[model samples]
Target: MRITVWDLPLRLFHWLLAAAVAGALITINLGVSWIEWHARFGLAVVGLIAFRLVWGVVGSTHSRFASFVPTPSAVASYVRGHWRQPGHNPLGALSVYAMLGLFGFQAVSGLFTTDEIAFSGPLTRAVSSDLVATLSRLHRQTEWWLYLLLGLHVLSIIVYRLRGIKLVGPMIHGRKEVDQTVPQPRGGGVLAFIIAVGIAAAAVWLANGSWIPVPPPAPAPAW
Candidate 1:
């Protein structure tokens, strides 16, 4: 039987977030000139994550955190080969949660980071210098952790493929072929999508420091 395992919004969110993260990583390494683009990509990540967090609550059955969150018993059951579930398994759910949390931290931290030359984060001026320095250091150091997590994510997909499970296809198309019947994903209709998008836009705007009132031209540079 074929079942809908991922909703359209969830599928789009997954791919778009992947592209945004990739762009961020690439532009960050392309030298100081690309810092602005890097920041833009980071903001995109922030927005996407915000969307995901909201969607995880109001999203479809399979996409909701309640559906696949890894509990101790669930993990033990899966480890004992007694658990057969659709969408993410216990270990996969753990990975998903970890990635979401780490990336969220990375994106939020970038909003206060500075290069001490060019490329200051949008929220840098809103925070104290000491806090900015700490976040900046963390932002730089967490890059390796991102790389490690990404590597593990890809490697897990490859391992699953070798074991004859077509994990990637379902993510791309939102459907999976299962031997047994599974409940189709529900909810996350237009209203939920709109709410998620609105929240994401608000997060982007806030992360851009739109609320930080700009000083008025420094009083025309008093002579």
Candidate 2:
């Protein structure tokens, strides 16, 4: 009954995304000087999701979709109490994928959007104004789905916790015990973190357009 729950990369990505999302939320709400940081954090989130997508393809057996994602009938049966799982189950995997997809969409859209004032995404100028407007609208509208997905994720965790599930522990430790057997993980946590960081940095660099410092506007002539 034992199973490798989450790869170390996935676990760290989970927590780091949580923290970055929190920071983005706070900075956005705080306004003023924080919006810049919010954009920066969102960029980081996009990178994290990108790394995850790549990892899902190249990662360990337990981390790959071939291992966890199940069919609709299987997910339903699990919900109906007809089936039990040792790892991500079925419904949870779908939710995970949904969150990743939605968030990635949100972040990518933001990059081509403009604040409708002076601040523009690094690539915003590359697109037509009409396209920028659409991307901006999409980016803003996607917030609802992001909020809904986040709520569901939290609710699922709460339900599992109430059911005496140590879900968070396994994420942190990358191991779980089921039916007297201790589960072993597939990837090394440290290696995963290093890889994740490198991927994130590359994504951010690309998004920022080489991080070439944007020069300030020239001062207005004296009256």
Top TM-score prediction, candidate number = 1
Which regions of candidate 1 deviate over 4 angstroms?
A: 216-223
* Candidate lDDT values, in order: 0.94, 0.77
Q: Put down candidate 2 lDDT per residue, 1-223, tens digits, no spaces.
A: 5466677677877898888777877787785567678789888888888788767766666777776877988888988987655667888789878988888887788788777665677777666899989999998888888888899888988999999987788889877766754446465355655675687678888887555566699999999
Consecutive 10-residue window with the lowest summed lDDT within model 2:
180-189
Residue-wise C-alpha lDDT for candidate 1, range 1-223, written one tens digit per residue: 8888999999999999999999999999999999999999999999999999999999999889999979999999999988878878999999999999999999999999998999789999899999999999999999999999999999999999999988889999888887787777789899999999999999999999989987666556657
TM-scores for candidates 1 onward, in order: 0.96, 0.83
Candidate closest to the true structure, highest lDDT: 1
- Candidate 2, which segments miss by more than 4 Å at Cα? 1-4, 180-199, 211-223
Give per-residue lDDT, candidate 1, residue 74.
97
